[model samples]
Target chain A: MTQIVRTPHEGPRAASAKRPGRSAVSRRSVTLITGCVLSGMILLLALVSLFWTPYAPDDTSGGRLTGPGAGHLLGTDKLGRDLFTQLMTGSRIAVEAGLGSVLIAAVAGVTLGVLAAFAQGWLDDTLSAFLDILIAFPTLLLAMLIVAARSATLGSAVLAIGLAQSAVVARVVRILVKRVLAQDYITAARTSGTSWPRIVAGHVLPNIWPTLVVNLALQFGLAVLAEAGLSYLGLGAPPPNASWGRMLQEAQATFTTAPAGALAPGVLLVLLVIGVNLVADGLRDTLDPATGRRRS
Target chain B: MTLLDIRGLTIRTTDGHTLVDDLSLTIAGGERRGLIGESGSGKSLTTLAVLGLLPDGMTATGSIELAGTQIVGAREKHLTRVRGTDAAIVFQEPLTALDPLMRVGRQIAEPLARRRGLKGAELQRAVARALEQVRLPEPDRIARAFPHEISGGQRQRVALAMALACEPKLLIADEPTTALDVSVQADMLDLIDTLVRERDMAVLFVSHDLAVVARVTDRVLVMKDGRAVEEGDVREIVRRPREEYTAALVASARRLESALDTRRAR
Candidate 1:
């Protein structure tokens, strides 16, 4: 009678093959669909903007403060730059920043976490202590420091956000890897002559990825917001790159004359974040190993 | 022809509390030896030590020579090389012993692919055969299903199949039927008996129950409080136990047996 306090999600919790059907299932799908539609809208715009915006984002091709018209579908800003094009391009950047930072975090964090989990006494202690200290440091401030060190550009903002968020990812990964290592199957795998790398690849990674994917998805929204915040502080990719945060900041002065200037980018940013969060929630429902929905 | 030989095997916690005292065991090629002890008597730890898989912070001293490989103080690299091909284990709880996330077929295919270099169509056939050997009906569906999707009996069968995939020299079953129902337990024992006999493999069957051990093994080693109390032929130990601890174990087993017999007769 070894005291193996297995994680609740594992074990005989859902031993029966009862189909999970309820209001909760239907509701999650609803949110999932809505999130997809919202997030898809931004992704579609970003893709389309790659080839075509209403006008060049830097073009002063319309009258200042002009209302939405056939010529400029959204309008023009104080600098007479096409607002529609700016917002479209801004989305591309938003998506880029979100995706970039998330990718970075997933890669760096999972690596550090796996290493720390496998590390022996002194190494494990050192890695864990370092991660804890990083966790205490604010992600945005770390990003800002990276921005300050390098020239204020898109690459630096992305690198900063990604590197800063990796610590959180790594810490979570360490706990997850350790939990997996404690399972009886892990011992079984070892006894079966599964090499360390094979066990990690087969047992460790497969057991952990469902939770990791969802975690990375949620971090996507935060990365988006963090990128925008950087842009607002004039620390994002330079103008014409016109990240939505920069749009919001520039629109701050012209709220009375043309509320759409601030309103458009602000609205898109909120919608995007909401969409990503909802999608993350939807993913959690979908990818949950407990519900046994992720088997295939 | 000795497949497993242990001398002065001792396990201690990092804090210096001894869990398993000086114990010795020897299993010849194709021999079946039963290690009987109640929980905390170090039966399971002995099995783990045989596989060189002692838990972290706990230390094992003294010699454990399995297939001529020294287990005590051996590096993980060398130990891993001896594992599976030399000896494989089926844990007490099949539900947790299995990777719940993996399909049954793939899990069985692991040792086969690793040890025998099976792949693709050949590997699939081997997996199905392993499932079939375990007497799992609908090997196709069961193979595709997850551990939780199958019944507890089927999961244990799958675990046995995985252990036997490469047909190792020895099989260590640590309370293999402890978590199983009585009828299923009988069937699993019968299955293990038939399969191991077919393969001519040695078995280290660890259990707390005398009746369970007697069913599958010829020899039994009675352990109490981390020390070997008595060791003899299974029937001899059960029929006329030597030590007080062993007598208690036999008495309890007899009580359970007659309890069942009376209920059946009545």
Candidate 2:
């Protein structure tokens, strides 16, 4: 057997040389790096807030309406609470909501999507119609209703946002799965005597994962924004917990007098959302077959 | 010993459009047969019916026996067992016939593991041996590479290795070299012919190209519009085609070959 196995010198070298275009690789890498850095900074802020803060987030000892000065990093809010501590804690809340909701959306959406793609005739049509109906209902409004009904807490907000986002994820997943199913390789796998479940595990899921990763990253940003909206409306995370949306709502009245109070949470919220969007953009560039590097 | 026996195999859609109309053929053990027809001539449908892989809403009627086992209307569970073990099919487009994301070795190993229960060192050795049998270079490296990592000819070879891995009694090559270049196509045809001879496997080679069908197959079946118009020895049919359809096909193929030869001479 060893003697029979020939070494073809020309083939492998030619194959390996077929790398992705230079411009495409560089562009994707730049996007991926920028996204990573921005998201990493937000995550770092959240992690740091977990251990320590500049001052007690709820403490009202600092002078009310003071500017940025010694002992006070971002000055104080109208109620004299440490502005920096509140902003840092708000970062943690944003991350939690983003991750939790995205998790929920992924699991439920992927299952429903796969089922719809595999189903035939009426069942497929019905699943697609149901998802369409869900998508038609506005995400924020749906989250608001769920939060109102369930008593707004971190868990409820996460659940509400996740359920609202699942429809969009499901739709994308269904389309991706349907496209993959139509490929010749799937037919080949079927002819190879591989069972449906095994084919899905071995072929279907792996092919669709890159697209799903990119879509889910975009959903993460959407999830964060939705959670913040709910928090601003006083239907997310409650008062005791520092949420960026709630901080923004609280700083609205004192906006003219103390600019930093409104600016601190607002700036951090914008940065985190931008960070997530950049990550999604980078992921799309990296995972897309047309843009990404190929083994050949 | 007849390896496959099909009698009155008619395939039709739910809307009652007949795709394969009462087609019947037989292949004995170690026999090599060619199914020659144009696109939409039901050559693929007939082969797919044998493997119980007809598309949704298409129903296959009449008897399809493989080693005396009924295949038409067989349950999916039983058909799956018969499929990579009793008979295996190598499709036309090597580019798409393989899972792009999966390593070639694991793709080949999957059926072997499922059909033969081979695992660990035994599985690895079996996959390497299969690759070697197809005359692919560096079996270990090729096995580790993804489908897109190899050239078209190499990919087709991998596909052959996968089909032959189970050492099935019957091998169905459904226009397996049609998607390859002219030079590579001959090499693939030679590989299939040599492998079939070595394994003593009954082959049902389907192709629209008369030249390719003639090169590998000993017996030929000429099909047109879902019907078998003629069947005879490969040489006899090519030399003196009985049916008008087969004669036309032979004439066209000859014309094309002669035209190519003239161009080469120029």
Per-residue lDDT over B1-266 for candidate 2, one digit per residue giving the tens place of the 0 to 100 score: 99999999999999989999999999999999999999999999999899898888899999999987899878988887787778989999988888877899999999889978999999999999999888887999999987767888889899999888878899999999898877777778888888888889999999999999999999999999999999999999999999999999999999999999999999
lDDT of 2 at A150: 82
Candidate 1 off by > 4 Å: A1-17, A22-25, A292-296
Clashing pairs in 2: none
lDDT of 2 at B107: 93
TM-score of chain B of 1: 0.98
Mind giving the per-residue lDDT tens digits that candidate 1 earns over B106-225?
998888898899899999999999988877777888889878777788889899998888789999999999988766787788889889888899999999999999989999998888
Colliding pairs, model 1: none
The fnat score for candidate 1 comes to 0.55
Candidate 1 chain A: 10-residue stretch with minimal lDDT: A1-10
Cα lDDT, all candidates: 0.88, 0.87
Lowest lDDT 10-residue stretch of candidate 2 chain A: A1-10
Chain A TM-scores for all candidates read 0.89, 0.91
